[model samples]
Target: MSDINISKLDAASADFDRKLQKLLAWNEADDRHIQQTVLDIIADVRTKGDKAVIDYTNRFDQRHISAAGELELPGEILKSAWESLPAEQAQALQIAAKRIRAYAERQKIESWQYTEVDGTLLGQKITPLDRAGLYVPGGKAAYPSSVLMNAVPAKVAGVGELIMVVPAPKGETNQLVLAAAYLAGVDRAFAVGGAQAIAALAYGTETIPAVAKIVGPGNIYVATAKKFVFGRVGIDMIAGPSEILIICDGGTNADWIAMDLFSQAEHDENAQAILISQDESFLKAVEQSIHKLLPQMERARIISASLSARGALIKVNNLNEAVDIANIIAPEHLELSVEDPEILGKNIRHAGAIFMGRYTAEVIGDYCAGPNHVLPTSGTARFSSPLGVYDFQKRSSLINCSQTGAETLGKTASLLARGESLTAHARSAEYRLKA
Candidate 1:
């Protein structure tokens, strides 16, 4: 194999920031045409109900189902899928499910209230969504991990019903995905996908029930449809390609670093894996290690393409410089593979998920590290976060005013209402005050 020539940049260079910006820029404008297509599909589902879902499933997934009822899988099928799994696979699934559930349990929100001296009760009441739609990528690439990540949290949040949609191209379905659904406590599983599936979930068909929110990752069409139906139904996030930014202090193994970079790159041609270090020699060594290891990877072509297109081997004056650059990028995954990762991690302000220390491989976090792998990407870690039980829960403010409390608060409310020229509101407050 030829030597991989990923982009090289020095943090001290004058044009470093400009070059970095260019690298980070993803052209979302090019997909404007998909919006109209998604809107049309959403309208079709809304109008024709189950019939539209059937038509789209038949056309896109090459299925022969004539009735919408056929799209919904039986609960027994999900249970059987779990039962038929090999012992190792089932054990792994159970282990991962247990860990994920344990973590999600910690994130569950509880209702709370307190009464004030004036007998005014104000607090928050927490409740889970009535139903949630989980989209799992099906077809050739099955993400059983995704099913676990998206479903377990909703279940932990006490969501009443969970509906899952996965594309079964040519009437084929993935058993592991099905098993995952069973293990995650999904109420219903459907063999449908793409923008049509999202639309059906957003706007309830006769067969498929509308959900309060939708959460999962999919192709651009699925993402576009999610964006269009966002107001009608909540979506977890409009995710971008996977990303990982590793900061090494020239202390870890070069081969380990190379494999870590390859982990995200093998995800797709657009996925990014960058390594930052203060030791220029270490960077060169890691690049050599990448060249040696790329030939052995199963997805070498994809890894090569991603590395060539978006991956980088960056050099900085010191570890502090690396942290500063990391904050600017706000990667989906940041690995502090340093001597004292905990100390270095204190400075990290952004990153969807941080894999601290050299021993914590990012792959573990993707599967069984007890955290949701559904993370923000394309530099969105600057604001967003990883998926959790909180996403499936809602908080409603509680306000109960006693007679004395109402009269005491009424004067302030009247003043504010009158200041805003809301005479009706002022009069309403005045009426409460007098009574």
Candidate 2:
């Protein structure tokens, strides 16, 4: 507890913005080595296809495979994994999947067209991508929740196929992930990972089919690979460290707030957890609660490091000030732990996911809360959104001009084209113009 040192900040501080900037700043440097390595891997996969994926999987993941055929897990394997789970685990997975599916069902977009006054039709055609690739981090980092979050929404969007790639380091696989693939209706899965898996998905291999888009979280190498392959394939987003910002009115249990901070901090040393409050005494109480409860946490060391390095206990003038700061920070997870959260939530403009009221813990949103846990991080909530069914679906502008409408539109197009000095465009439109 003595070594646990979380920063304390006041909204009235003279250098508050500077201190906040220092705290929130995450250095995302593009290392030449990593980019070059990813490029080489992409080139290899592009040229050699399945052989490259096999070779990299064997070398990086400590596997011995004579053929790429062994890389893909059969549908029977996924089914068997789901069936082999204990009753309790299976029930929990099903519950979470059901809730996620139900939430996603409401987000499905429908194509619609409307006739204009001039007998012209204008609307949008909504269509789902043919295939989407999901990358799940393997080893100890494997998250069954990630599989459910990414796969369920894509399935709900009516994507033709959901392909999954998970790295099974040292030939070890997690049954929970496989079971999730089964429950979430993953069409195919491969036990290959890192930059190689991303390249294979983006460009296609003999064994693994190419996908239109890729989604899910990964390590730095995987993130870089996603960045490199963006134009070739659609990606969810370049995710950053997980974060949580809580606004409390000194009413909720100090212990609960402290534990909530620990929840995100325990994710990793770089993860951030911040608490904002109007009551100075409540801030002190929460700090004491953090000191008292952190020792009992399983990931105490990690939480301590994260809190000490990035965590903050902020004292604001009032709850409104707290929301102002939250909007500026644009945290991935924002909790309004106040008496009336709905009122405060109205003022909140930016947040990946908002947890309302004292009873709503941010952890619930990560699991079965019926909203996407795959949210934009690193202040991306200011513009980006949570991964949803809409991500898998695309919109194409629809335009059906009647003969009368064409004549009028073509004349305008001809005038505009000629003004831009494009003779071919002008002539093409002029040809359609009637007299």
TM-score of each: 0.98, 0.99
In angstroms, give how far residue 370 of model 1 lies from its true place: 0.2
Who wins the lDDT comparison? 2
lDDT per residue as tens, model 1, 316-412: 9999999999999999999999999988899999899999998988999999999989999988888999999999999999999998899989899
What digit string (tens of lDDT, one per residue) describes model 2 on residues 1-435?
347899999999999999999999998786999899999999999999999998998899999988988999889999999999999999999999999999999999999999978899999999999999999999988699999999999999999999999999988999999999999999999999999999999999999999999999999999999999999999999998899999999999999999999999999999999999999999999999998898898999999999999999999999999999999999999999999999999999999999999999999999898999999899999999999999999999999998888888999998999899998998997787777
Give per-model CA RMSD.
1.0, 1.0
**What stretches of model 1 exceed 4 Å from their correct place?**
1-3
Residue 434, candidate 2: alpha-carbon lDDT:
74
lDDT of 2: 0.95
Q: Score each candidate by Cα lDDT.
A: 0.94, 0.95
